[model samples]
Target: MSDLLARHRAVMPNWLALYYDEPIEIVSGKGNRVVDASGKSYLDFFAGILTNMIGYDVPEVREAVERQLATGVVHTSTLYLMRGQIELAEKIARLSGIPDAKVFFTNSGTEANETALLLATYARRSDQVLAMRQSYHGRSFGAVGVTSNRAWKNSSLSPLNVHFLHGADRHLTPFRGMSDADYVAACVEDLRHVLSTVVGGDVATLIAEPIQGVGGFTMPPDGLFAAYREVLDAEGVLFISDEVQTGWGRTGSAFFGIQNHGVTPDMMTFAKGLGNGFAVGGVVARGDLMDGLHAVGLSTFGGNPVSMAAANATLDYVLDHDLQANAARTGALIVDGLREAAPRLPIVGDVRGKGLMFALDLVDPATGAPAPALAARFMEETRKAGLLAGKGGLYGNVLRMAPPLTLTVEEAAEGLGIIVDALETVNAEVTS
Candidate 1:
């Protein structure tokens, strides 16, 4: 074992997972590439699970944070008036698409979702919630309960009466082969049935990832949430779009992934890319729902000035530079390349994603079943080829890629070449 791995294992919890058979210790990064402790550089395809929205060592983001650092006061608590926080919130509110949208900052996506839950439950006055099957909101106590992915649920107990909904994981579902319209219809029907029977009384809200992030980039058909929103609207259940991974123009087609479906969520929680690696997460909600939380509480680190500065700069960069259009154009190159190569590569069962976010379902070619072992081997091969990627899925058999939005066409080609080579190498080893 590597010395660092041995040290990590001795101190860290065994359940805290690490990627790769021999994990590479990243030491530094710039643009879309990172260098390991051993001084080996790699094309960072995952971009820290889509958190580095723009890129690493970004001058704009760095300068903003540096300017805040020079101010000497970083944490003033949410009790005081903060210019940075309010300005960032204003930008987010305008872009949120929710009329009279109010912003609440948190330290992470999990907290943002939790705060949204608190407001939602209080507003609707119920503990019942509708969560998507194969979803992963976060790892916190409240988050774990609503996470429908079995692997992510460490605890047997939950605070909310969570009812799992179908249609998120299209590949695993019986309706996998269904057309987009049919799949959307089936999912909508499931939502209607659950609301009418399972909950019985009022459901606080239906929280869902716009594109199920930790669930292996599982994407439901367009208009899926639109139908869900329609059903929930009639029942007075709020719709919360968890845009932790799919926010910040990452989806290419829209600012938030829910926008693609033509539905503006009652509440939208975002984090990952918004801060561009600074700790920033928040929820934008309708005025009534946001103000409905009766308890007097404050998040000490929720709106740290430094973080707010980073987020403001990041958002400004994203908007001024038009990263959304960039995501769409660049993401297409990777998606098209992967789709084109899927037929030639035997282990590749499916290529699914939109914009900068997408995934490759690795499987046993003969059986067409999820091949977790093969996925592991494929990751190792990519590491050897100096391409850092991501792995996830309900079955742990998918290779996910959400590179920085600023990935150049040439960089995309280079990454694709490395990916194809790695896949080929892994395929040969398995089939041999």
Candidate 2:
């Protein structure tokens, strides 16, 4: 490890995960790349966990934050109305399909999910919630309660009575071999049975990520959530889409990942890319649900002027450039390229995802077992090849790639080539 990495390990929590055996401290970034302390450039495929939506050093976002800094009012609590905050909220409300929507800002996805859960429980007067298996929301106690992943759930103690559901992850399910229509039907049946038999009472809400981010970029069959929405309507359970990883057109086909499911959520929480790396997150809810919280609440740093300005400028760039269209176009190319290349690679078992959000599951070529060690080796090799990707899964065998929406076809091809080369190199070494 380098000196900086040693310093980081000495002071930081041991539980805090870092990529690579010897973590490289990135000191500078440009459009689609970052330079480490050693002055080595690496193509940034993960884009800071998909937070840098536009790319590094985006002029609009930087200028907006710079302008806010010049104003000299860094923060004033939610008691004061700031123009940037109001404007950003309006933009979010317009984008959110919930009827008479209202926006409550937070400092991160964890807080956004926390606020949504609070609104949900208060509105329905129930602490019971439904969540998906292999799902991860945030690290907070409340968020962890609903998170079903064993690796991320550090504690069994939870504030809410959370139940895990099935169907989000095809790989982990016994029904993976079934056709899409049959698979969705099976999962929907399970959800209904769970609601009727397990809880049998008021379930405040069913919260799910459109694409299970940390659960290895796993996705359910299309229209699965829509089927669940029908059940939620009958059972009087609200729906919350945790779009922290899938929002702002990152999914390539939809501006919001829930759109692909063909159902509008009662409430939605977003973070990650909205502010393009600035600390910003929020919950958008229907008017009644939002107003149901009788207790007074205020976020200290939520929707502060700087974050609001950053979000405003970022959203403007996203909309003006029609980055969603680009995501669909180039994302299709990347997916097709990966699918075509997977046949030639021995370790790759699956390639799945939408738009820019894609994942490759590594497995033992002979036995078809998850190869997490191979995944780790490949990650280091990818870094050495000057490309940065992310790894996830309950088994830690999935390679995730979600480059900025602004990635050109040329960049996509270049990065995918590097990935293919890394896979080939690792395959040779592992087999040798």
Residues 165-248 of candidate 2 have per-residue lDDT tens digits of: 887666655886889998898889898889878795799999999999999999998899999999889988999999999999
lDDT score at residue 126, model 2, on the 0-100 scale: 96
Badly placed stretches (over 4 Å) of model 2 are: none
**What lDDT tens digits, residue by residue, belong to model 1 across residues 1-432?**
388899999999999989987777888999999999989999989998889888899999999999999989978999999999999989999999998999999999999989888888888888988899899989998899899888988996888899999877666558868988988888888888887786768899999988988899998888888888888899888999999999989999999999999999999999988888999899999998888776798889998999999999999999998989988998899899989988988899999889989899999988999999988998898888889899989999999999998898899899989988888888888777
User: Candidate 1 deviates by what RMSD?
Assistant: 1.2
Error of 1 at 28 (Å): 1.3
Provide the TM-score for each candidate, comma-separated.
Answer: 0.98, 0.98
Assess candidate 1 and give its TM-score to the true structure: 0.98
Error of 1 at 183 (Å): 1.4
User: Among these predicted structures, which one has the highest lDDT?
Assistant: 2
